[model samples]
Target: MNKVIDINADMGEGFGRYTIADDERLLDIVTSANVACGFHAGDPRIMGLTVEKALKNHVGIGAHPGFPDLIGFGRRDMSLTPLEIKTDVLYQIGALSAFVKASGGHLQHVSPHGRLGNLAVKNREYAQAIVEAVLSFDSSLIIITEPGELAVEAEKRGLKTAVQLFADRAYNDDRTLVSRKEPGAVIHNQETVLQRCLKMVLEGTVETVSGSEIEVDGNTLCVHGDTAGSVDLAKEIKATLIEAGVEVRKLEEWL
Candidate 1:
């Protein structure tokens, strides 16, 4: 069987009349979309349109829940109790679910956004809260994230998970992503990023920041929708995967 993988991107990050990424064009390339659910960057109008466009393009839809920090785009750190994180996540997912249902598309997964996602990596309390929120909503929802505490927590709760490798970020030797604060953390060269994606799928490994390659078990590739020339990059990566005999499918159909 051909190696199967899913390509996902964060979409619907714009609010009001403001626009972020070209989500419409992104839907054409990505197999799954992690639509922002208002608390972070998206609003009702953008969420509805994003889900509608993604379903029309045969792309799987997912809720991207984040901390309620629109100013920092959910990247900055914040203090919140376990109960707060759980309820915040539930509210955000519910908000996005409405849009998905309205468009006649089922929600395929839930991916915690930005700070919340980062905290869940090593924070057991945060990870458990996210898992609890997902279970409370839909136990079948696939938790899409990088391999970390969140992945372990989700599996513990009998929920499926899809591991995603970032195409434009640097990784540490331990399979953790290099911090954005560090230099050379985010790669801009499309060729290099494309090579990393291929390695993660074909060889199950990626070169770390220390110039060492670590084995990675990734079933999905995450493309940044808000970056410059990202639409073109997504298109190129999709074409490259197809040419390499990899099946780029939706997360729902597989893991």
Candidate 2:
């Protein structure tokens, strides 16, 4: 059997009249979609349409929950207790789950968005809260995250987890992503992105910004759909992986 990997993109981020990214085009290329629930972005119409499109394309649907910070796009840090975080996450998941069920598709995974995602990597309290939230909602939901506290906590709670590698971002020596505010954080060059992805998948290592190699295991790779040329990048990455004899499939298949 050939090696398999999943390609996921953050989608359904538009809110009402304003839209971001070509989610339709992305749905054609990505194996899974991390849809933005109402807390951060996306409204009821966007969510329903996104779920419908994803089901039509046979792509896995995932809930992308974030802090209730629409003005900051959920990238800004928020001060909230563990219980608050858990309840917020549960609410978002429940909203998306209803849409998925209505569309005849199942929720495949849960990926915390923006700052919440960053915190989950190192904050034990936040990680545990996210894990508990997912378990309380649906224990079968796959937790998509990097190799960090979130993944560790999710696995400890007996919830399925999928390690995700970023295709368009730079990494630090510690495997955390470089802050978007920093220089050269988001890699826009297609060649550089492709090279990094191939190396990470085949070699199981990534060269950090500090010029050091670190072990990085990933079952899935993510490309931010809101970025320029995201659909093109996804297409190229999927084609390259398939050509290299790596099966590009949904995370659900592997789990």
Candidate 3:
């Protein structure tokens, strides 16, 4: 039997002063949601509403922490010490955790947003600090990260981790995502995205930009809810995975 995988999306990104990311429709199709904390794109009100929505929809909840770069929606990298990164991540997780708990919901994981996520994948120091903060805040929470780096680091640190793969992003020769600034980074074509995801989940491999196939582990798959056609893409991906007999579940269930 094919191993089950969880499908997650980044939601609750709109803030008090700014609105971005259409995520409500996409929520129904995804099993898990990573909500932004204030530092990224959410405010208290947004977080509360997001928690309620997720609970109503029976979706798994997570904290989506990122650097304090509102102008870039935490997509831009920032220079910060390891301690600073730890502090900010902890603060964000704590803030989101409150809303989830108050709503009688549990936070299932922590998926760092944007640049911080990319950094965590390669930098052991940053990964350790973030994993430590996550474990400290809630021992039960899972850390969703790339298969090799952050996931490995988190597991080594005795924190539960999920190897998360991206279905809508292109990979470089090393399996890292091609920079978004590049021309062909985000896969907007639905048919292509579907084919790529099928191969990744069923074949357990992906073709990198260098035209070489590499083995990859996909415990969970993420489709950015804020992206164009996000709702449609998520629905199609879920349908395809289910049709292939791959159980799509929340991270909590898998853990």
Clashing pairs in 2: none
133-245 per-residue lDDT for model 2 (tens digits): 99999999999998889989999989999999999899999889999999989999999899888888888888889999999999999998888888899999988888888
Q: Pick the candidate with the highest lDDT.
A: 2
Give the per-residue Cα lDDT of candidate 1 at 110: 94
* Per-residue alpha-carbon lDDT of candidate 1 for residues 125-173, written as tens digits (9 for 90 to 100): 9999999999999998999988889999999889999988899999998
Off by over 4 Å in 3: none
Q: How many residue pairs clash in each candidate?
A: 0, 0, 0
Mark the regions of model 1 whose C-alpha exceeds 4 Å error after superposition.
none
The pairs that clash in candidate 3 are: none
lDDT of 3 by residue, 110-178 (tens): 999999998999888888789878877887788988865678878887888888889999888777899
lDDT of each: 0.92, 0.93, 0.87
Q: Which runs in model 2 stand beyond 4 Å of their true positions?
A: none
Clashing pairs in 1: none
TM-score of every prediction relative to native? 0.98, 0.98, 0.96
